[model samples]
Target: MGNSYEDECRRSLAEEQAKSLAGTNNWEHVDRERVHQDWDVLYREITPFLDGGSLPGDQQIQEFVRRHFDIVCRFYTPSREAYVGMSLFYAEDEAMRAFHDSYHPGLVEFLGAAIKVFAEQGSGFAPSAGEASA
Candidate 1:
């Protein structure tokens, strides 16, 4: 977030990475209809956490993150490493961050934390709040 060249470069790189992923053949399965329908369900599920009515690790939140992780697995690889990388892009990429924050302040950060926790639970790895996002 600093004004350094490295920061902007990171943002730009992550944006391109996200674009590349979305442009892949698997993205065909993620049509507008599917996105809209899934968003409806996801929106309902994530609202409480996003609105501060619940915490990040709440059962609903865990389920939401699990569903989110499943979506990513469906579209792409199931590697925890890849999921972690995607979370980085979601939080660090300028456009991705803006899109998620449009839903709520710190939503991307919270989502990143939740996703990383969900992925690492099986591996017994624990990450700092923004470290996975970073």
Candidate 2:
């Protein structure tokens, strides 16, 4: 009845991707097209088990999110690093807060990973020292 390690990982990945996409500063408009493409890629890669045309169950959804997170973090080759960071950062937007919050226990790990990736990739950004500690 609780979230599994895998589930948590998936959720974390999604959350991280979302936060990174959102970025630290508010922008007039986020590139929805790019976001959708990135999400599509993640969705296709994870192939989350959906039920009744929706995510399987809270537990299953969590697992799917975790798996996607791992893939986003681990799949980036040196050449694709920039794109991966950009895609993950684009995922973090106000519109997605609800989607991220839907999962209980939250996907903090995903958010953390995204931040780490963004920083490491030199996405022309950095979380504040406090945020970095977070």
Candidate 3:
């Protein structure tokens, strides 16, 4: 009796999540595929820069930052203000923070700074509230 209600609630939550993802670009074939590929590709581009030391405004770093910017825009289509709010969530949301931090010791902080640079200078700086993905 005690466990039945909890099980039903869990099932309901799972069903809701499935429905939500099913209707979004998040789970749709093309966008999900693109994001997965870029996830790896971007990591490759940024990892070297992360290890190389400073985020100098060289062509490569700029390009790396640009990719990040474009991906965010492509995903979130956020206005500038929404982008800042999303960045705050990325930094503060415990689950997101844990996911980012797991990548490296200081990856969360590094990405925060990098995102700032990307938004502040990149041509596609618009951010939207519902656009950002995990």
Instruction: Compare the candidates by lDDT and give the number of the best one.
Output: 1
Q: What is the lDDT of candidate 2?
A: 0.41
User: Model 1: per-residue lDDT, tens digit, 1-134?
Assistant: 23453344345445544664677853665565776678557856685677766766767788887777655544544445446666677777799888777777778878877776676663422232223543
**Order of quality (TM-score):** 1, 3, 2
How far is 22's C-alpha from truth in model 3 (Å)? 13
What would you estimate as the lDDT of candidate 3?
A: 0.58
- lDDT tens readout by residue for model 3, 9-121: 34443443345456664645447678768865776557666777866455676677667667754544545444444555567779977866666656666776665566567
Count: clashes, candidate 2 = 19
Among these predicted structures, which one has the highest TM-score? 1
lDDT for model 1: 0.62
Runs in model 3 lying further than 4 Å from the true structure:
1-30, 56-59, 127-134
Native RMSD of candidate 1 (Å): 7.3
For every model shown, what is its TM-score relative to the native structure? 0.63, 0.25, 0.60
lDDT of each: 0.62, 0.41, 0.58
TM-score of 3: 0.60
